[model samples]
Target: MTSKKLQVIATDKAPAAIGPYSQAIKVGDLLFTSGQIPLDASGQLVEGGIEEQTHQVFRNLQAVLEEAGVTLNNVVKATVFMKDMNQFAIVNGIYSSYFGDHKPARSAVEVARLPKDVLVEIELIASTVVE
Candidate 1:
């Protein structure tokens, strides 16, 4: 049996992993990203409302995906965690704007809290190459 190789992907464009984790891990052709909050590259949380925070989260996600040799278009699945469920529609709008026509499988849930008290966090699983 052939064993798969796990590769850690890191980039200076995105906020560095704050804890004990890689920004993303690539196994074979798949890339799994850690949950991205609204933190900037300096580890400072972006100051703004939901829409702005969403943008920061996507920016971070894009950075990590790029480091893994992929783009948001390659995402096959996504998970969103929010501090409040009442903001679902707003978050959905921003998310749709980012993804455009590429609809990936997703799940969004309201969590008790998130790192840095941000309004939203996002994570993704994607292919290393666009199909």
Candidate 2:
């Protein structure tokens, strides 16, 4: 039998997990992140509409990714949870800017509610293998 060690990934740059969950977890060469809301490092939700909130979510994701020694470019899959599907276009634009040329597999869906009732939340899966 073989086992892959689990490494909890965290960073002060992002908001601390509010519940019994880690910011991210790395098992073997894969890093799986928790859903990040639009909360700052101090745990205060950012003030703004979908645009600002979405940006904050990305910032939080970036911090967690960095802690795992990976970048957005290394992300293999992303799951976005939005409060409203109507804002998909706007959110997609912001998402595009962050991802730039690296297009990873993504899934975005509208949910009834989210943590802190934030406009958007994002989670990602990244490859830690430095190839």
Candidate 3:
């Protein structure tokens, strides 16, 4: 049996983990990130509606992804947790702007609540082997 080395990914540009967890983890060619809420690097929740919140979440994701040596274009899968499904379209628009033409497999769902009671949270899985 063989085991792949795992590396914790983190950056000060993103909000620090509120609990006992790494911002992301890199194992082999994949980087798995923790769900990112709309908290700023200082760990305060960003103020605004879903649109602003979603954008902040992407910022946090970008920081973690960069720490793992990847980017949104490297993301193969994404899972979005929303407090309101009615805001999906708004979030989708902001999400599209970040990823641009690269579309990754995605799943979105309305959760009863999220950490810090924020409007939205997002997490990603990216490939470290960027071509």
Candidate 4:
């Protein structure tokens, strides 16, 4: 058996990984992205409520996806974590706006806390081989 080399994806447009992890990883046609918080490229968490934070999270995800040569449209799966489930509507609205008509499989849950104590975080799995 042979091992397949995975490609590490990164971009200055997105916040640098906070720990020892790549922004995303690609193997073959699949790209797995790390959970993105509301931090900007400088690694400072954005201001405002869940709506604003959700938007920032999506922005970070977009940058990572673009770096991988994909977009939200190429995402096949997603995972969402929010500090409060009460923010679902706000987060969902922003999420729908970003994803548009392309709905990917998803799982969402309210977590007690998140990195940087941001209100929301999102991660995705996308296909780089867009058909």
Enumerate residue pairs that collide in model 2: none
lDDT of each: 0.93, 0.94, 0.93, 0.92
Error of 4 at 55 (Å): 0.6
Model 1 worst lDDT run, 10 consecutive residues: 63-72
Instruction: Tell me the spans in candidate 4 whose CA falls farther than 4 Å from its real position.
Output: 1-3
Candidate 2 wrong stretches, greater than 4 Å: none
| Candidate 3 accuracy as TM-score | 0.97
Off by over 4 Å in 3: none
RMSD, each candidate, Å? Answer: 0.8, 0.8, 0.8, 1.0
Q: What is the lDDT of residue 43 in candidate 4?
A: 91
State the lDDT of candidate 2 residue by residue for 38-69, as single tens digits: 99999999998999999999999999998888
Write one digit per residue (lDDT tens) for candidate 4, span 1-131.
77768999999999999999999999888999999999998998888988888888888999999888888999999999999998798888888999899999999999999988888999999988877
Write model 1 residue lDDT over 26-131, tens digit each, in one string.
9988999999999998889888899999999999999999887788899999999999999999999999999999999999999998987889999999988666
Ranking by lDDT: 2, 1, 3, 4
lDDT score, candidate 3: 0.93
- TM agreement with the true structure for every prediction: 0.97, 0.97, 0.97, 0.96
The residue ranges of model 1 lying beyond 4 angstroms of the native Cα positions read: none
| 36-104: candidate 3 lDDT, tens digit per residue | 999999999888899889989999999899887788999999999999999999999999999999999
What TM-score does structure 2 among the candidates reach?
Answer: 0.97
